[model samples]
Target: MSLLKKYCLLGAALWIACAAPAFSEYTALSTLLAETASKLEWNPLLESGVLVKDTTQVVFTVNVPWVIVNGSRRINVDAVRRQHGALVFPESTAKEIRAVLEQTDIPPKVFRVAAIVIDPGHGGKDSGASYVHTINGKSIRVSEKDIVLNLAKKLHVTLKARYPDKVILLTRENDTYIALEDRPYIANTIPVKPDDAIVYISLHANASMSSAAKGFEVWYLTPNYRRDLVTTASVGKEYSEIVTIMNDMKEEEFTRESVLLAGEIASQLESAIGAVTENRKIKEGEWLVVRKAKMPAVLVEVGFVSNLEEATRLMDDAYLQKIEKAIYNGVSHFIEQFEQSKGFTE
Candidate 1:
């Protein structure tokens, strides 16, 4: 039988045996546990007692209308009194206490990565790192915009197939130019609960004046670059100092997650194709994309377009597939770790 039902069956204990003037129905501490099975610990000298059942605990004192519940919530009830060296409370107070134990005091919050945003860098008028090279009398051209878009689409498809329950989105699905500032806006605008988190990953290809610089590099925002992430609407303008501190704390949380994500992707890249070229390793930067994003964010430079050897490899469909696979594995691993760790509190 349920605790509430059993307690209700013991209504005889709440019967008023004799009342001179007051019609109050009180139950004695000794009779409280009679014909019922919930545990009660009472201290007569201290005039205090505690009732415990399942996950609920109720603490009360003699001659007090207020009762401390679960050591946190203080609830008001009819005053408990010491009658003939025994503690007891009126019927109304008993009902109120019973109601408290049946409800409220839910479990702690849990964290989850519910949404992911993939931003393919540069498109349309702003063809990022445009390079024209001729290899063995054959004209070849490589655009960073096109390469990253292909990779982003592949990654999106793979992730969507893997996690159909989660939300996966792209800043620009077609070959359209998206402003740098607008990219992060897509990620920030995603509505999520306080315990829920979002991930923002921007894909790009690197370029240099010298053709020698070639490798895949993952970038995360530097910890030193503080973002102005506080919103005044949540709190009053007079609490600006407190708001700044709170914002700083929130910024640190996203930064930590971004670093973890960057590390995972960098390690996966090395594992994917370490023998072919450089992993370049995860670097710290004040990138606008990462800075503006209000969630965990990272930027990946898949390879260099300026280098003939790297550019030739980048043009290959199979090569881009390898890079895409590496990124997918990295993101998958990070999401697993993040969810399992419950936002990495320890």
Candidate 2:
């Protein structure tokens, strides 16, 4: 018999033997497990009190609230435990599981993705922020523009290799200047099918005078763009007004989805660069690429080049590979979650 069926039978027998109040309806975590997981096993001796297999197996250990989801450690509000010969946890735990199920659930409809746009910030004459380090009596200069361009190229290559069928475009393929307003315009010009999805990622490296400021972060457009922005166009009055109205609507329309994607990327960044620093954060910011792009867009500060230690690490080829992989994983995760949430079957 299935776990849920057995539990129902047991509950019926117990109801006949004792007062109904003895058993609370809310404690049916096993029913939730049976409904959600393709397979579940309860073994007290096992390190995790309960084992669930959902595409991949995840273990929830007793007393330890964290659960391993597809090899990533995610915080769970409550720990898994065995009670009265049954695997159980707090009601909040069930709610958490429900949330995960909702995120991963397959949707009835799918939005076809047309293209993925990659923007590397500050190119050509704009060398962007730089940090100088002396090594063996030789001066080494690390420029944010160069590092971001390199990283964007690596990401482009990786994304192309992984999603061969998808259209992936880079704003500037080399060290050439592309106006901030024009970057998103390039993506906007791409022809796509109706309701097709598009994603924009702006690659950047932050700098600070404090030198102590270092860590990865992601930024999405906030909802209140019109109130926060100041119009600066004087010559192209008509064009400026049209752009402003479009940007304002885009920001308000995609805030929730952009924040969701940002959260996923930020969460994975913490795992990828945890050794470097655990101070990763996500915030709302207005940047041309993020604000002007009429799609789910985000700006990622891979690392701070201003900090001496981070500059050295960011300059490393192998570390750059890790950052690229982290970004790929985060983006892939968001795509999957978004597809499932939207009920996209394709």
Candidate 3:
């Protein structure tokens, strides 16, 4: 062969040898790329081969045909299937990738609770009223103060048991006179952070001029004149204004929420006690106790002390237990609704 021909033949041989391995490497890379693409459910037509979209700041490479979740110091992806057909990811990598998924379109889980305060009405010198009833040929007198205190105690126990994690507090534990002004003050003064939630309920029994009329009723604070009836009688006009001002502040803070909370508790109590007693239905009232509480506050009149039958039941421990259960159910229902509305599952 001529020198030029020989040289050309040598060059051709070298080129073929180099091209063979290059073709093999390309074929292997193509297979890996296809597998990764199939696993990621990405469109094969849109992307192919190694793509470095950016290289200036943080490098984003599409070399392996897999999506990478970038973390502070590393990148992560779901592990490829193994010989045993097991699909898994490194714990750390899975966490990082999950975080990215959550940030992209999924919401993180959260939890919240509804705090509550319980107040049993009338203590110490305030013995409230009493009623005499003849049952089983025996006369029994049920004192309003004692009956209400026992009911409050039962309510606290029931609520605490039902919602162990939730915060529940009582204004007075024993027969002590907690000044009406100081009741709301204690509620408002609870050391709560900015994000804390709270609700309050004051318990009492109703009295009426007609002893014939009797049933259970719930009260939420309203600006009606009737609310003033209680405060006016309790405190003189001069002190009433101060009380009114203080109550206004509390109402402003909890007006909207108080209505909702009262409705919830009332519904539960009516359901529980109404089965045994006459259905009183939930009523709106401007009772002083409900009006003055700082947080979402309500006053629950379990039954009428004026009624002979209800006054008798009020003394029964078993009947009080039923009322306690109702109060617990109401509080639980309220908390559930509030948490759900806020998107807090826990």
Q: Indicate which candidate wins on lDDT.
A: 1
Query: Model 1: residues >4 Å from true position, as ranges?
Result: 1-106, 135-137, 235-241
Model 2 lDDT, residue 316, Cα: 89
Clashing pairs in 2: 107-343, 108-343, 109-343, 109-344, 110-344
Q: CA lDDT of each candidate?
A: 0.77, 0.68, 0.56
lDDT of 3 by residue, 1-346 (tens): 4222343354344324323322211222223323333112111222211111111011112223133221112243433221222122333433443344334343332324546788888888886766777866898766677887897888788778877877778888899887787777677667764435677888888777788777777777663322332254444443332334323322433555566667777777777777767666666666666666655677888888888878877878998888888777777776777666532211
Tens digits of per-residue lDDT, candidate 1, 65-174, equal 77766544667788887565445668777777767666646774476899999999999898999899886679978899988999999999999999897899999898
TM-score of 3: 0.57
Number of backbone clashes in candidate 1: 0
TM-score of each prediction: 0.69, 0.61, 0.57
| Candidate number that wins on TM-score, 1 or 2 | 1
Candidate number that wins on lDDT, 1 or 2: 1
